[model samples]
Target: MTKEEAKKKWDLTRKMLEITDDEYNGVTQEDANLRFVKMKLQIAVYYMQLLDEHDSEYQVPWNKEQFKWALRKPVGDKKKQQAKEWCHQCRLMRDKTCTNWNYEEVKTA
Candidate 1:
């Protein structure tokens, strides 16, 4: 998902699930399976946000295997470069470094 889409997603998830950034920080590591499941749902929502924003036809597979595949896919060369620039700009606003280093921005949506 693009950065703006990602931000829009977390805004919704954070509100719906009462999830703060602090909570997300612990989810992926503290309790591996359940948190990962939660993350998958959040990520599905994130990608949906992307689809809405970009008018992309990409479809997300909701099964466990799909989540694994999504997690494995690379950001690609050009998008990776752009994402890094965006990430750096985002990092400047937060005191703590991102745990999800590849796709994080400050919770400022």
Candidate 2:
């Protein structure tokens, strides 16, 4: 089945299972499997959020110079290393010096 169809099926199955103490006693194997899938999905979503937050922390402002640098073809290893260092420095400076980094500007740009 397609991803959307599987998602809809999972949602429907989860909704059908009532969350109550009494329902725990007679849990069928199918119910257990569905619960396991639901738990895995929850964990996967949590990890994805964590990864997104981690990536955002490393985000640097993209000005004209940076944009131009990014568009350059056949960048040398030295240039790539320099760029990585510059990005790292930017993140450090942002954390230490800039107490209020303009997130709205970053988001808009």
Candidate 3:
């Protein structure tokens, strides 16, 4: 899928959730855990195309650093409860631009 396509999807999800509190509590039995899936998807989509390791054009970088940056910490700064918020924001902004790319590749055909 193209960046615009994934971005459209992400925007839709973000619009539905607008606020983190609404997102965390609105979904039943989720307990704020699954609330991050949306933000994670943002990071995933960004990493798939927009990272220094790869050119501006769509290219996948298969390297240890990429894997480490993407997978080492799905939840950034897990030590603090407030950290979840940071993690969600970081991933949403594509701070490392790695998380969702790996997962999307796995789940995709």
What is the C-alpha local distance difference test score of each model? 0.42, 0.41, 0.42
Best of the two (2, 3) by TM-score: 2
Candidate 3 local distance difference test against the native: 0.42
Worst 10 residues of 2 by lDDT: 45-54
**16-105 in candidate 1: lDDT tens per residue?**
433446655654433343344444455445444544444444333334454343334242443334333433433332213333333523
Candidate 2 has a TM-score of: 0.29
Give the TM-score of each candidate.
0.30, 0.29, 0.27
List the lowest-lDDT window of 10 residues for candidate 3.
53-62
Task: Give the distance in Å from residue 12's predicted Cα in candidate 3 to where it truly belongs.
Answer: 5.8
Instruction: Enumerate clash totals for all models, in the order shown.
Output: 0, 0, 2
lDDT for 37 in candidate 1 is 41
| Pairs of residues at least 3 apart in sequence or in different chains that clash in candidate 2 | none
Which has the higher lDDT value, candidate number 2 or candidate number 3?
Answer: 3
